[model samples]
Target: MSKQELPIIDASGPGTACCAPLACKPLSETEAAELAPLFKAIADPVRLRLLSLIACHEGGETCVCDLTAAFDLTPPTISHHLKVLKQAGLIDSERRGTWVYYWINPEVLTRMSALISPASPAPTGTA
Candidate 1:
Protein backbone atom coordinates (compact mmCIF):
# COMPACT_ATOMS: atom_id res chain seq x y z
CA MET A 1 0.00 0.00 0.00
CA SER A 2 1.25 3.52 -0.78
CA LYS A 3 2.22 5.74 2.18
CA GLN A 4 0.32 8.59 0.54
CA GLU A 5 -3.30 7.91 -0.35
CA LEU A 6 -6.60 9.87 -0.34
CA PRO A 7 -5.29 12.45 2.16
CA ILE A 8 -2.46 13.45 -0.22
CA ILE A 9 -4.92 13.93 -3.06
CA ASP A 10 -7.05 16.34 -1.07
CA ALA A 11 -7.02 19.82 -2.62
CA SER A 12 -8.07 21.46 0.67
CA GLY A 13 -4.57 21.89 1.98
CA PRO A 14 -2.55 25.04 2.77
CA GLY A 15 -1.94 27.48 -0.13
CA THR A 16 -4.67 25.74 -2.05
CA ALA A 17 -7.74 27.26 -3.74
CA CYS A 18 -9.86 25.48 -1.16
CA CYS A 19 -7.91 26.33 1.99
CA ALA A 20 -5.12 28.02 3.97
CA PRO A 21 -2.87 30.83 2.74
CA LEU A 22 -6.04 32.87 2.82
CA ALA A 23 -5.06 35.41 0.17
CA CYS A 24 -4.13 32.59 -2.17
CA LYS A 25 -7.71 31.42 -2.15
CA PRO A 26 -8.91 32.16 -5.67
CA LEU A 27 -11.80 34.40 -6.48
CA SER A 28 -14.32 32.68 -8.73
CA GLU A 29 -14.47 33.89 -12.32
CA THR A 30 -17.99 35.10 -11.73
CA GLU A 31 -16.89 37.19 -8.73
CA ALA A 32 -14.13 38.85 -10.76
CA ALA A 33 -16.59 39.73 -13.49
CA GLU A 34 -19.04 41.18 -11.00
CA LEU A 35 -16.39 43.28 -9.27
CA ALA A 36 -15.05 44.76 -12.51
CA PRO A 37 -17.87 47.24 -12.95
CA LEU A 38 -17.65 48.26 -9.28
CA PHE A 39 -13.95 49.07 -9.59
CA LYS A 40 -14.59 50.92 -12.84
CA ALA A 41 -17.13 53.10 -11.10
CA ILE A 42 -14.56 54.12 -8.50
CA ALA A 43 -11.77 54.75 -11.01
CA ASP A 44 -12.67 58.44 -11.43
CA PRO A 45 -11.31 60.97 -8.93
CA VAL A 46 -14.57 62.88 -8.92
CA ARG A 47 -16.47 59.81 -7.80
CA LEU A 48 -13.97 59.15 -5.03
CA ARG A 49 -14.22 62.68 -3.73
CA LEU A 50 -17.98 62.63 -3.88
CA LEU A 51 -18.07 59.41 -1.95
CA SER A 52 -15.71 60.81 0.65
CA LEU A 53 -17.88 63.83 1.19
CA ILE A 54 -20.98 61.75 1.65
CA ALA A 55 -19.24 59.28 3.92
CA CYS A 56 -17.77 62.01 6.08
CA HIS A 57 -20.89 64.08 6.31
CA GLU A 58 -22.37 64.83 9.75
CA GLY A 59 -25.30 62.53 9.20
CA GLY A 60 -23.28 59.91 7.34
CA GLU A 61 -25.53 60.69 4.40
CA THR A 62 -26.42 63.63 2.18
CA CYS A 63 -29.25 64.88 0.09
CA VAL A 64 -28.79 65.16 -3.66
CA CYS A 65 -29.47 68.89 -3.47
CA ASP A 66 -26.74 69.43 -0.89
CA LEU A 67 -24.34 67.27 -2.86
CA THR A 68 -24.76 69.18 -6.13
CA ALA A 69 -23.85 72.51 -4.58
CA ALA A 70 -20.34 71.34 -3.73
CA PHE A 71 -19.55 70.38 -7.33
CA ASP A 72 -18.94 72.71 -10.26
CA LEU A 73 -20.94 70.41 -12.52
CA THR A 74 -24.67 70.72 -13.05
CA PRO A 75 -27.05 68.84 -10.73
CA PRO A 76 -27.79 66.36 -13.48
CA THR A 77 -24.08 65.69 -13.83
CA ILE A 78 -23.72 64.95 -10.13
CA SER A 79 -26.81 62.78 -10.28
CA HIS A 80 -25.26 60.75 -13.06
CA HIS A 81 -22.21 59.96 -10.97
CA LEU A 82 -24.38 59.07 -8.00
CA LYS A 83 -26.36 56.76 -10.21
CA VAL A 84 -23.19 54.92 -11.19
CA LEU A 85 -22.21 54.52 -7.53
CA LYS A 86 -25.68 53.24 -6.76
CA GLN A 87 -25.53 50.69 -9.55
CA ALA A 88 -22.10 49.56 -8.43
CA GLY A 89 -23.45 48.68 -4.96
CA LEU A 90 -21.01 51.12 -3.39
CA ILE A 91 -23.85 53.41 -2.41
CA ASP A 92 -27.56 53.45 -1.73
CA SER A 93 -30.12 56.22 -2.17
CA GLU A 94 -33.50 56.82 -0.61
CA ARG A 95 -36.21 59.29 -1.48
CA ARG A 96 -36.91 61.24 1.67
CA GLY A 97 -40.33 62.72 1.07
CA THR A 98 -39.15 64.85 -1.89
CA TRP A 99 -35.34 64.94 -2.04
CA VAL A 100 -33.23 61.81 -2.34
CA TYR A 101 -30.57 60.80 0.18
CA TYR A 102 -27.38 58.91 -0.56
CA TRP A 103 -25.11 57.01 1.78
CA ILE A 104 -21.94 54.95 1.56
CA ASN A 105 -21.88 51.16 1.60
CA PRO A 106 -19.29 50.43 4.29
CA GLU A 107 -19.07 46.74 3.35
CA VAL A 108 -18.03 47.60 -0.18
CA LEU A 109 -15.46 50.08 1.10
CA THR A 110 -14.05 47.47 3.48
CA ARG A 111 -13.76 44.91 0.67
CA MET A 112 -11.98 47.43 -1.54
CA SER A 113 -9.55 48.30 1.22
CA ALA A 114 -8.75 44.63 1.66
CA LEU A 115 -8.25 44.14 -2.06
CA ILE A 116 -5.79 47.04 -2.42
CA SER A 117 -3.99 46.60 0.89
CA PRO A 118 -0.21 46.41 0.52
CA ALA A 119 1.29 43.00 1.16
CA SER A 120 4.39 44.49 2.80
CA PRO A 121 6.07 47.78 3.51
CA ALA A 122 8.86 48.90 1.18
CA PRO A 123 12.40 48.29 2.45
CA THR A 124 14.37 51.22 3.88
CA GLY A 125 17.58 51.74 1.92
CA THR A 126 20.04 52.96 4.57
CA ALA A 127 19.10 50.73 7.51
Candidate 2:
Protein backbone atom coordinates (compact mmCIF):
# COMPACT_ATOMS: atom_id res chain seq x y z
CA MET A 1 0.00 0.00 0.00
CA SER A 2 1.12 3.54 -0.69
CA LYS A 3 1.54 6.30 1.87
CA GLN A 4 -2.01 7.45 1.21
CA GLU A 5 -3.38 4.08 2.27
CA LEU A 6 -3.85 3.44 5.92
CA PRO A 7 -6.23 1.43 8.09
CA ILE A 8 -9.52 3.31 8.31
CA ILE A 9 -9.98 2.48 11.97
CA ASP A 10 -8.29 5.07 14.16
CA ALA A 11 -6.68 6.65 11.12
CA SER A 12 -7.15 10.40 11.30
CA GLY A 13 -4.99 11.23 8.31
CA PRO A 14 -6.18 11.98 4.81
CA GLY A 15 -7.46 9.40 2.26
CA THR A 16 -9.46 7.72 4.97
CA ALA A 17 -13.04 7.46 3.73
CA CYS A 18 -14.57 7.04 7.16
CA CYS A 19 -17.89 8.43 6.03
CA ALA A 20 -18.26 7.08 2.47
CA PRO A 21 -21.04 4.51 2.50
CA LEU A 22 -19.99 1.28 0.89
CA ALA A 23 -23.31 1.01 -0.93
CA CYS A 24 -22.58 4.27 -2.67
CA LYS A 25 -19.32 2.99 -4.08
CA PRO A 26 -17.14 -0.08 -4.32
CA LEU A 27 -14.22 -0.45 -1.93
CA SER A 28 -10.62 -0.51 -3.09
CA GLU A 29 -8.31 -3.14 -1.68
CA THR A 30 -6.96 -0.60 0.79
CA GLU A 31 -10.45 0.34 1.90
CA ALA A 32 -11.44 -3.30 2.29
CA ALA A 33 -8.36 -4.06 4.34
CA GLU A 34 -8.96 -0.97 6.43
CA LEU A 35 -12.57 -1.82 7.19
CA ALA A 36 -12.17 -5.56 7.73
CA PRO A 37 -10.85 -5.17 11.25
CA LEU A 38 -13.76 -3.01 12.29
CA PHE A 39 -16.16 -5.67 11.02
CA LYS A 40 -14.18 -8.42 12.69
CA ALA A 41 -14.26 -6.66 16.02
CA ILE A 42 -18.04 -6.86 16.11
CA ALA A 43 -18.26 -10.32 14.50
CA ASP A 44 -18.52 -12.02 17.89
CA PRO A 45 -22.02 -12.47 19.32
CA VAL A 46 -21.05 -11.11 22.71
CA ARG A 47 -19.22 -8.16 21.18
CA LEU A 48 -22.15 -7.29 18.92
CA ARG A 49 -24.55 -7.35 21.86
CA LEU A 50 -22.13 -5.36 23.93
CA LEU A 51 -21.96 -2.70 21.19
CA SER A 52 -25.77 -2.54 21.04
CA LEU A 53 -25.97 -2.16 24.79
CA ILE A 54 -23.56 0.72 24.78
CA ALA A 55 -25.12 2.41 21.76
CA CYS A 56 -28.57 2.15 23.25
CA HIS A 57 -27.59 3.19 26.76
CA GLU A 58 -29.04 6.30 28.31
CA GLY A 59 -27.08 9.51 27.75
CA GLY A 60 -25.23 7.64 24.98
CA GLU A 61 -22.80 6.01 27.36
CA THR A 62 -22.51 3.06 29.76
CA CYS A 63 -20.29 2.12 32.64
CA VAL A 64 -18.27 -1.06 32.81
CA CYS A 65 -20.13 -1.97 36.00
CA ASP A 66 -23.46 -1.54 34.26
CA LEU A 67 -22.33 -3.62 31.31
CA THR A 68 -21.09 -6.59 33.32
CA ALA A 69 -24.56 -7.36 34.66
CA ALA A 70 -25.98 -7.79 31.17
CA PHE A 71 -23.95 -10.90 30.36
CA ASP A 72 -22.91 -14.18 31.99
CA LEU A 73 -19.33 -13.63 30.95
CA THR A 74 -16.75 -12.49 33.49
CA PRO A 75 -15.63 -8.90 33.84
CA PRO A 76 -12.29 -9.57 32.22
CA THR A 77 -13.98 -11.15 29.20
CA ILE A 78 -16.24 -8.14 28.86
CA SER A 79 -13.28 -5.85 29.19
CA HIS A 80 -11.55 -7.73 26.42
CA HIS A 81 -14.52 -7.23 24.16
CA LEU A 82 -14.56 -3.55 25.00
CA LYS A 83 -10.88 -3.37 24.19
CA VAL A 84 -11.48 -4.83 20.76
CA LEU A 85 -14.22 -2.29 20.15
CA LYS A 86 -11.97 0.50 21.23
CA GLN A 87 -9.16 -0.70 19.00
CA ALA A 88 -11.53 -0.88 16.06
CA GLY A 89 -12.71 2.70 16.74
CA LEU A 90 -16.31 1.53 17.03
CA ILE A 91 -16.33 2.81 20.62
CA ASP A 92 -14.46 5.01 23.03
CA SER A 93 -13.91 5.03 26.80
CA GLU A 94 -13.05 7.25 29.71
CA ARG A 95 -12.16 6.40 33.27
CA ARG A 96 -14.39 8.20 35.75
CA GLY A 97 -12.68 7.74 39.07
CA THR A 98 -13.02 4.00 39.78
CA TRP A 99 -15.34 3.15 36.91
CA VAL A 100 -14.74 3.09 33.17
CA TYR A 101 -17.43 4.37 30.83
CA TYR A 102 -17.97 3.47 27.17
CA TRP A 103 -19.77 5.26 24.38
CA ILE A 104 -20.44 4.47 20.75
CA ASN A 105 -18.62 6.43 18.07
CA PRO A 106 -21.66 7.58 16.17
CA GLU A 107 -19.70 8.57 13.10
CA VAL A 108 -18.44 5.05 12.74
CA LEU A 109 -21.91 3.63 13.25
CA THR A 110 -23.34 6.01 10.70
CA ARG A 111 -20.69 4.94 8.26
CA MET A 112 -21.55 1.30 8.91
CA SER A 113 -25.25 1.97 8.47
CA ALA A 114 -24.59 3.74 5.22
CA LEU A 115 -22.34 0.92 4.08
CA ILE A 116 -25.04 -1.73 4.40
CA SER A 117 -27.91 0.46 3.22
CA PRO A 118 -28.75 0.19 -0.45
CA ALA A 119 -28.11 3.26 -2.49
CA SER A 120 -30.48 4.67 -5.09
CA PRO A 121 -29.99 3.11 -8.50
CA ALA A 122 -28.32 5.28 -11.04
CA PRO A 123 -30.35 6.49 -14.01
CA THR A 124 -29.90 4.80 -17.38
CA GLY A 125 -31.30 5.25 -20.88
CA THR A 126 -33.07 2.35 -22.59
CA ALA A 127 -34.29 1.84 -26.13
Residue-level error in angstroms, candidate 1, position 22 = 9.9
Q: Give residue 37's lDDT in candidate 2 (0 to 100).
A: 77
**lDDT of model 2, residue 105:** 82
Q: Give the local distance difference test score of model 1.
A: 0.67
| Candidate with the greatest TM-score versus the true structure | 2
Candidate 2 similarity to native, TM-score: 0.75
Off by over 4 Å in 1: 1-28, 120-127
- Per-candidate alpha-carbon RMSD to the true structure: 12.4, 6.8
After superposition, which runs of candidate 2 have C-alpha atoms over 4 Å from their true positions?
1-25, 121-127
Model 1 residue pairs with clashes: none
Using all chains and alpha carbons, the TM-scores for the candidates as numbered come to: 0.70, 0.75
